[model samples]
Target: MCSILHIIGGVMNIAEIGQKVAQQRVALGISQERLAKLSDLSRSTIHHLEHGTLHEIGAAKLFKLLSLLDIQLKTESEVTKPHALEMASRSASVSYKTTISPQELEESLITGKIEPRTISHLATLIDELPLSLIVLVVKEISQRHKIPPKKIWSHIYSWANQFKSPRLAWQ
Candidate 1:
């Protein structure tokens, strides 16, 4: 099975972690039985872990499985904020005639001021940007502009309503 896993808020939920493990095991051409034997775990355990059916697993066992699969977990503390902001700006600028600058986007977001020209771009951003990037951008903007995160979210919610954004995150 193929799966995509996204870690948000510096954490991977259990299902995503399981999907990662399954991806790595499949990439290595390792069967569940072989993986169980190699990791000194039961085949049922491996199956449950890969299928995300297991309720909980010990850290040592998870670490051993990941070690066997050569999967390393990483946390992006300082790196993700700027990258997400840059990505958001780039996403907002994907227009034909008018492009919204990062500063303009930030100002608009903070002050609830949407320029007429950038409305379409902002709507596209609201509709298409990944939820994680949206969350990161909101967090960065809130911290930098001294606006409460709730206020920023309210602004986004208003934009989403005005634009009729189809994205579930915005909805």
Candidate 2:
């Protein structure tokens, strides 16, 4: 998954922002042509966005695009710092039925064990999980998939803030 900041960060370069937009559009199952028609942007613009070559897109258009895909961009000023995560005990684990061991999951959460290639898949998975399970799954995937701990935590923090609930349920 693209970083939440990939779209929301004020300091992101054009290419990075475009990539985020394209990624979310794809995730939402919209084709470039369809997105162009919906956003009233040119097909060439959509193509450029997916290709990360769009020089400039207006803020309204960008916001509309993300909104259409169910992404809400929030600046740092609009969000608060995250409180510490309250993880569930191992006995109260959420069942993903993956081959990963509980011990491995615990270790990864403690010591950022990210595997880059798996980040996108993990992001997709995390999106569908209940809020109670998201933190654990993200931590597990980030550690096993080798994603940067700070980056994954930022995504979780933003999500937690968006939902107006910093506390996650494990049971």
Candidate 3:
């Protein structure tokens, strides 16, 4: 289980904090566009922050982003001595498998059997993967769910389009 932490009192650096934020976001399978919408920040701002190029983030926005990522930035005095430097743990609870059987995956998707709450997990699992891999998965999904691959592809495309440039809210 990967987790992100930010120690505010003695270890607060803008660049490091940005990296931590990016780590948390990716671990959550969240895209920058989604993070921006949830935090009310611009995609460029999210990009800059992830790349550690943004400085002087406002407190409200910072809080919003951290809260959305399930991150905790704590002061030194709030914690005990030995663990005083540690921020609260926000673990990526989803356990992702490297290879899910097509039938199982199809059934999971059709029956809403995924552990994570969002359907974006399907996109995340497929993103940057090979075409053969995608085809195999899609074939199973189509066969089990009785939906054509063309339709599934359309939905995936629409979701990708939305993710590429997310609007003001979760769609």
Candidate 4:
């Protein structure tokens, strides 16, 4: 009996929390998309919350919207800061910004100032160039500049395609 009591006492239940949020949304008869627009959050966020994808949404953003809609966030003294859920949510929100442009990355390649391997790594991370697009850009630069860009272009192309922006989920 003591073991059963302990198991029930220590369990953290978030189902009631989720239900409360859904109840509010349903009371207003507002769709997830509409709530997203009103809260300046992505539609997926509202969808995930209603469907109980709470792990994908950060506690900060979730509470933010709850506050906007006059909903309260409750805790049983078991909550902790900076959960994995928060980190995952933040990953989807990060945008890519590069120090150089596609033209510059290609120019560095053509000038022989950059190693082929370095260019490959940069292409994967540049986001703007991607792999296929990088090849086109590099080929154009190599042709106009009289550089032997043959296999290098195709190699980079294959490698760049493998990268998937994890942040795109939130976008």
TM-score of each: 0.61, 0.39, 0.41, 0.35
Where does candidate 2 clash, by residue pair? 1-120, 113-143, 114-145, 114-146, 114-147, 115-145, 115-146
lDDT of 1 by residue, 9-83 (tens): 576677778788888888889999999999999999889887889888898998788777877766555444565
Alpha-carbon runs more than 4 Å astray in model 4: 1-16, 77-171
For candidate 3, lDDT tens digit of each residue in 1-171? 434564643546778778988988888889999989989999999999889899779988987888778888765632322221111000111344343444434554445445344444454543444343445555556665677778766654565564562432213
* lDDT digits (tens) for residues 87-144 of candidate 4: 3223322443323344445544444355444443453443442343443455455556
Per-residue accuracy of model 2 over 1-171 as CA lDDT, tens digit each: 433643232444667667777778878788888989998999999889768888888888877776776665556531321221223222223343333334443443455453444333333333444453545455555556677667766654554454454244311
Which parts of model 1 are misplaced by more than 4 Å? 1-31, 34-80
Q: Higher-lDDT candidate among 1 and 2?
A: 1
Instruction: Please give the CA lDDT of all the candidate structures.
Output: 0.80, 0.55, 0.60, 0.50
Scored by Cα lDDT, where does model 1 land? Answer: 0.80
- Tell me the spans in candidate 3 whose CA falls farther than 4 Å from its real position: 1-4, 8-11, 77-171
